[model samples]
Target: MSKLEILALSGSHRHGSFNTALLDNAKRLAPKGVEIKIYEGLDKLPFYSEELDGDSIHPEAKRLREAIASADGILLAVPEYNFSMTALLKNALDWSSRPAGRHVFVGKPTAIIGASSSILGSIRAQLHTREVLHALQADVVSRPEVLVTQAATKFEDGALKDETARLFLVQVLDNLVAKINTSELIKTASQEKAS
Candidate 1:
């Protein structure tokens, strides 16, 4: 079987964002045969507007769309902003969902995780993100939810040094991979049926 392509996205724009660090750690813990790439240009995307999405869309937006289109699944690491997903991350999703018929987020397999200095650990933001993904027709993994609270203490030098957090992240990845594989199988069968 071919390796699964997983695109990782960090919603935080802070230079030392713990959420982004969490995603880095996730890459380190990914299992064999699972290819992971981080999407690092969310800050460059403009707010979504149909009028501006004509023949000349922003290059950054185009790049993000292409990345999502080619990926088998998405792993989002979000940071809570006033108990919600950061505006930057939400805007990126909005941009990716435009040109309605050609939406890049539709039917994509996704998993959400978050880290925060707060005790709640961005759990609310992750939940909100899952709802948004569902609205976009993405299949979001519901189990093994990851919310690393007190992130400053949990991670070090962009790595998840905590044993428990690492284990939880592994389970989250396993669930995401399973969901992606199942979706691919379903798509293949449907195509076969059409044939």
Candidate 2:
């Protein structure tokens, strides 16, 4: 089989976002046989409307779907906004989840991490995001949650400077890959049984 590829999305679109930096760190720390691709253009995706979702759907939505479809798993570095995930990320997910069970996020393994300047980190946002993913039927990895709270102290020069946080993020990525592997194995076994 080919290498497992993970598509990473940062919930924040702010300049020099800590969540985006977390994804950058994940890319650098990913284990061998795994690849992390960070998705850009979240800002380009228009608001999702089922009325426009059929043939005239926005091109950016299609890009998001294609990107998710090509990945073996997804890695989300979400930031909190009013104790919930950013609307930008939610919009992208809404676009990707269209057409019901046929969307790319279904059955795909996903892992979530977050950061914030507050001591609480982005835990609330992550929880909400997890629930949404679960509703979409994504196989979310539940262990080794990484929440980089007080981000001002943990990151510097647009990178994750804290060793502990870096290690935790790496653990999350590793677990994501493992979950994807398990999913693939199950799929193969089910196919064999059907044959």
Candidate 3:
């Protein structure tokens, strides 16, 4: 019943990144009572290292972990490079999935969307991201995938202009909220049963 806070991560840090634009549009189209915020520190994160991942973790990594831990769900605007997810994204994931028992991504509701110039529209990146999320035990929304292929033709001035893509993005957000709600319901039921 409370507002939902959804954190979005874009894989690209380019000046005019299509993935960033896609996330912007997603923020605009997010349903009422839900807030979608973009995480902007991926480029600042150093490559994951166990030595630095102890109590002395980088401030940015700590920020990223806190954001993921507090959000009701996660939205990813994945970008593909070399037929896989960008290092920025993978690095963020690696940084967040640390300390073994206290990872924030476990059981978190997640949804994936992407945009690319390639015809496949970052499909490989999203697939690879899903695999990584699975390994972290995150719950992912699996329906109505949003893959904006040939992205240059689908947006105008950094906003998603394609009606079909907009529809799919909205559906993805809705499904993410539904997943979060379902998780809350199950948790409440389990607590009641235990009581």
Number of the top candidate by lDDT?
3
Per-candidate TM equals: 0.96, 0.97, 0.97
Count of backbone clashes for each model? 0, 0, 0
In candidate 3, which residue pairs get closer than 3 Å at backbone N, Cα or C atoms, i.e. clash? Answer: none
Backbone clash pairs in model 1 (N, Cα, C under 3 Å; residues 3+ apart or in different chains), count: 0
lDDT of each: 0.89, 0.91, 0.93
**Which residue pairs does candidate 2 place in steric collision?**
none
Q: Residue 99 of candidate 2: its Cα lDDT?
A: 86
Per-residue lDDT tens digits for candidate 2, residues 94-129, read: 998988988888999999999988898999999999
- Residue pairs that clash (backbone atoms under 3 angstroms), model 1: none
Query: Could you tell me the TM-score of candidate 2?
Result: 0.97
Candidate 1's C-alpha runs over 4 A off are none
Candidate 2 vs 3: which has more lDDT: 3
Predict model 1's lDDT versus the native. 0.89
| Poorest lDDT segment (10 consecutive residues) of candidate 1 | 96-105
Give the CA lDDT, 0 to 100, for residue 139 in model 2.
Answer: 96
